[model samples]
Target: MRRPSTSILFIYGLAITLLAFIYRDPYSLLLISIPNAVAGIYLGYRRAKLIVVLLLLSIWGTFLNAYFLANHGQVVAVLGPLVIREGAVRATAQIGLRLLAIAGAALIFIGGAEPEQIIRDLEAELRLPKTITFSLAYALRLIPLLRRDYSEIMFCRRQRGYRRIAYLPGDIKTLLLPLLSIAYQRAIWAGITVELRGFRKRRPRYRRPRIGLVEALLLSWLALQVVLPIMAGWTM
Candidate 1:
């Protein structure tokens, strides 16, 4: 049998969120947050990591600020706000750690997913409405399509009496209009293609696949994702 795909991992991760809704616990919420951020990193790369780290920092910072507000009672004197105070620093540290944990979790799942697999699973396995599924599939393709169009637009602008100079609005001006126009055209074309491809067709009945060993294991993990957060929150 073929190995379980990246889409499955993402689904597993998403299951965690549903679990969070079912059980509101700060501790479990924090636990779930870590995996979500890590999943983002895993899906992308350095960019994902950067995003997750920033997020963790932000959360930890908030906690630090809370601590300071409760304990230090804000710094105010003849100087009028002496460099934010120690609590501020501590808050920042807390936020940083939370963000790091989130980033780590995102990285784990993102590394395991493939864009193609994700699209296919969303389209077929998930039994999402056809129209929405197709829209998402097209959206996944948009990044590359936009990049290619942008490159072509830039090249054309450069040829048409537009020289790119450092630190100048002229560089952006040369390409922006054409890029916008191309993007609009592409979006229209994609919409038409999807419409013609019967994406809006009536929902077709699908035969569910029997849960295999791997799927069963993944499902179990997902179930745990739901249970753990609430349990953590309750216990904490």
Candidate 2:
């Protein structure tokens, strides 16, 4: 299967994130989470197994949330005479749907697109500024680097005889400034390397990636995001 463009993924991510916060109804929560789960499984380009596991966890969490809400009697439906089951049985199904949709969208976007490809697509296809594209690329790399650095810093602290070993949150508080400083230094060196290699002064270029069915479908999805709310009178 062909990969989705960056703009499509961005739109999908933004849309679900938007919906997650927009509606108060449990059904809306389901709507948002389902896509997140699917996207997590299908759209991820890195650590496929890990992504799938995380997606499943998200799906599970949504189900649990719905189940919790149902127990409170907040989620209820009346069918012609007989009422539907009061709690988890109903809420689980509702929330499950949303989680599936969310993961699916995430999988579609992130699963196939590589970091460089995504940045390029964003810059060229989406017409984002080159600076922004570069910044995003840098930021994306930093996510993993930050994690690694945090580990190293903690190790160094332990090796140097610091007795207090903190958990993730505590480690974060102690390590953030130093980690950030290291990251900044690395970024500056990377920037200098790019400049030395003449990347900064390179002439602009573009690719004519075929606007095929995938692109068409993605455009439709993007358009739907704008049109659906207007037609349905739903703010999301």
Candidate 3:
């Protein structure tokens, strides 16, 4: 299937997130989570796995705090200072699932487009200023480039007799200065390159993304999901 445009993908993400807040029950939240999971896997299963891992950690933190310090209602367990209660467990599950839905939905937007395309969408569709858009563009490009640079730095370190710990990010302090210098140099050149490529010149008018059957089907699912929570009397 052809990928939906960046703006549409962003709407899909935003809708999923807002619905997460609206559906407070464990089952409703679980229902909402399906869309994000499906979308994440659709984007890329490898990245989806990473998103799931990160969200699981977030859910675990939610579980621990709710089960112990924030315990409420009928007591379920008593482990000295750490108490477990029926209400807390229920509340925790609802909260954890909501986090999964919200966080994963956001990835649909983050991985949806190239930095230049995102900048174009923000400027054309959202009517943002060029200054704001270009800065965002640079930051977006910076993250992935830094990841590549980090691996290269680690490789060079390995050749220079540094421990394997250097490869594992345990030697991050040694990386900061080099990464900073590299970033400063890149920023200067990137700015120069962009201008030389007609940064100040007006390009042709931006084209809006075509909305079609894919959009209709996705929006239909969202509408149905929204109605279910209301029909079932779920609320945040």
- Measured against the true structure, the TM-scores of the candidates, in listed sequence, are 0.51, 0.55, 0.64
Model 1 stretches with alpha carbons more than 4 Å out: 1-10, 19-24, 46-124, 146-185, 201-205, 233-236
Query: How do the candidates rank by TM-score, highest first?
Result: 3, 2, 1
Model 3 residue runs over 4 Å out of place are 48-50, 77-83, 110-116, 128-206
> Given candidate 3, what's the lDDT at residue 54?
43
Candidate 3 local lDDT, 1-236, one digit each (tens)? 66566666666777888888877677688888866766765664443344554466567667766766667888888888866888778878788878877766766655665556877876776565677767866775676677677678768878877764532233544655677799899999998999998888845355666678776776787787788877978764
Please give, for residues 1-236, the per-residue lDDT of candidate 1 as tens digits: 54555456656655554554443344655665555555556555642333443354356446545545733535532235444545554454444444444444445444554556555565566676766655545654665666567567657766776764312344544555676787789889878886797766746554444457766777786677666655655642
Error of 3 at 189 (Å): 11
lDDT value, candidate 3, whole model: 0.70
Among these predicted structures, which one has the highest TM-score? 3
Model 2: residue 2 alpha-carbon error in angstroms = 2.0
Model 1 TM: 0.51
How much is the lDDT of residue 70 in candidate 3?
Answer: 67
Clashes of each: 21, 29, 0
lDDT (Cα, 0-100) at 148 in candidate 3: 72
Residues 38-108 of candidate 2: C-alpha lDDT, one tens digit per residue: 44664453534434543455555655565455555543656586344557555665555555555555555
A best-first ranking of the candidates according to their lDDT comes to 3, 2, 1
